[model samples]
Target chain A: MNSYYEASARERLRLLLDPGTFHEFLPPSERVASPHLLQLDTPAAFDDGIIVGKGLLDGRAVLAAAQEGGFMGGAVGEVHGAKLVGLLERARDERPAAVLLLVESGGVRLHEANAGLIGVSEIMRAVLALRSAGVPVIVLDGGQFGCFGGMGIVARLCDAIVMSEEGRLGLSGPEVIETTCGVEEFDSRDRALVWRTVGGKHRYLLGEADALVADDAAAFRQAAIDLLDTKPDLSLEALTAEHERLGGRLERFGACRDALDIWSALGIAAPEKLPLLEADAFRAAVAGKRA
Target chain B: MEKLIYEFDGGAPVKATQGPAIVGVVGSGNLEVLVEPENLGGRCVVEILTAARGFGDIWKAVLEDFFARHKLADLRISINDVGATPAVVSLRLDQAVESFLGGAS
Candidate 1:
């Protein structure tokens, strides 16, 4: 299987979209690199570590963006965040069939600290605005960097999310949590514990992610195509319902420390076995128990 | 960060019919190469912005080896490097050239 987790941003976009249909905006030839990195004596990427463009997904016009995880942990710098915001703003105007964000970021670049934070905020607003404009925003998270920090919040703000078992999503990353809360609270080096806590499987079971896919590109493609029609309801009633749902989730699972505990509380038999199951089997096992 | 420029005489100008091609990523121990077609009077110019300071001699050696192998000309090669070894740099240069020549995508 061609793992989506292992593919670069460009490779993932190429594999996810129709062949020869991706037209990049501000490509490397444009030489639109970050000026902050150079002043800080840091290396800068040509495309600013994010590739945003228009592409055809199942022959449907769509705006897409992918973050290069190998570059500075896919941090959102000024240019990187601007590229995505520009895409979403364009989507708002063009009203494409869908907008796909293959997010693989640890979020805000420390080099451009304030600019990166402002960029993330702008991206959040743009995504929400696009959704309010009736454009379906879909997030595909399966890369090794996963999504953390501000990017994690951006992913959740989308209309729908498709994640692979290898992918993880959370506000604060494992290392951050360990650093701020102590290793006794969250061990960053314990890969298994980290995955179990924030992995795609857990997110899907928690209803945080709409679809749970395998790590292969084909699986992500199929899942993205399937979710192209999902338009989130941003109405007052919908917002109230969402608020209630989240409050209920906190009330029910706030005390749960680990995902296994949450799974057990959801009444799934042999909760430990849930992690061992493949995507298909895991979905089947938690079909009725998902929150 | 250090900016280095090297220009070399070449056998023939490269016929980059397919616009411009880029490869590699600016990551730890890796670099990105952007090869653009230009009219340089049968000369190849390589410009690099590298994070590893005080490696001008090593970079010169690597680019010399690359120009020797490819003999490319009339091309503007730009590289963003982050402490990549000579082997990886050479490999990315060849990959960039191959992509520029439409041999690989």
Candidate 2:
């Protein structure tokens, strides 16, 4: 309740949903752990680090999935990916009011290698399918691991994304960038630089995330409830508008070195004060400044 | 990785409400325990697949202490460990049993 950022994946879903409404599918007793982990001599979690099931969100039927970031960085393995795909595919038939995806993964599991990559691709397609079918797929990003890699792309494909200030959404994580591009390119140890670049505030300002809330489960729950009726437009005109909006953002701020520069370009007065502001105040101040 | 199994003569069968009660997460220096009611005939079985090898004796001592504290019967306790300390293992075991008896939380 205090912090969704620190709660376990199961704890997050339990707190986010109506009390005692959650019913897990392929529970740990099913022993559906990754076979690749076993082959690689790695410890395998019983549920493959993902908890997927049906639950009532404010008395409406919903399918949800929570990724255990503590286990293997919540990386998508064969089984984990399959579970998500199965849930999304189920939504096509169940036609739940909405599908909540509590994302906390750091992309594909390296232990599973190619299988992990293929699994993420399958999940991406499934998310698109669900969205095309008019099912509201919402992402709650408040986990410590921060959604990145393939999972970040999957988050973008969803109908809506709600994030907490403690949450981060990006393609390549700081460590990954520092490893691939030299330390000079990105100092992963600089926590301030990391947050300013990919933190929830930055994503929200860039119009990458739909809403920003506090790092508490109740805030996320409220935000999800508010957006339950939202159905993203998938028509050709809407897609073209989105494409043009992204292109215009790139053309306007592509040369900016930091978030502050982008914020300044958006005519935000005193952009440095953004992080210090509280969630509600921040939302008010950045009303029309977002990309 | 090492696989260890321990079975003990227990007291009464667990009166859990539904399916298995799972606790903990398989992170570095952490582990997950799955407690499921089974027809073990007054026995509790623990199966561990640990990333840290050569700690079988330590695991046995810890699990022994756990079974002594909670004399749960007809339970299938499975653990997937990633070099978790004995204290963490005991904590997860206790949490698992507590959830098993009180229903999944």
lDDT of 1: 0.92
What pairs collide in candidate 1? none
lDDT of 1 at A75: 98
Score candidate 1 by TM-score against the native.
0.97
CA shift of A152, model 2, Å: 0.8
Candidate 2, residue A107: the lDDT equals 97
TM-scores of chain A across the candidates, in order, are 0.99, 0.98
- What is the iRMSD of the candidate numbered 2? 0.6
DockQ each candidate and list the results.
0.93, 0.93
lDDT of 2 by residue, A1-291 (tens): 569999999999999999999988898888898988899888899999999999999999999999999999999999999999999999999999999999998999999868889999999999988889999999999899999999999999998999988898999999999999999988989887788789999999988899999888999999999999988678999899999999999899999998899989989999999888888999999998888
Candidate 2 lDDT at A51 equals: 95
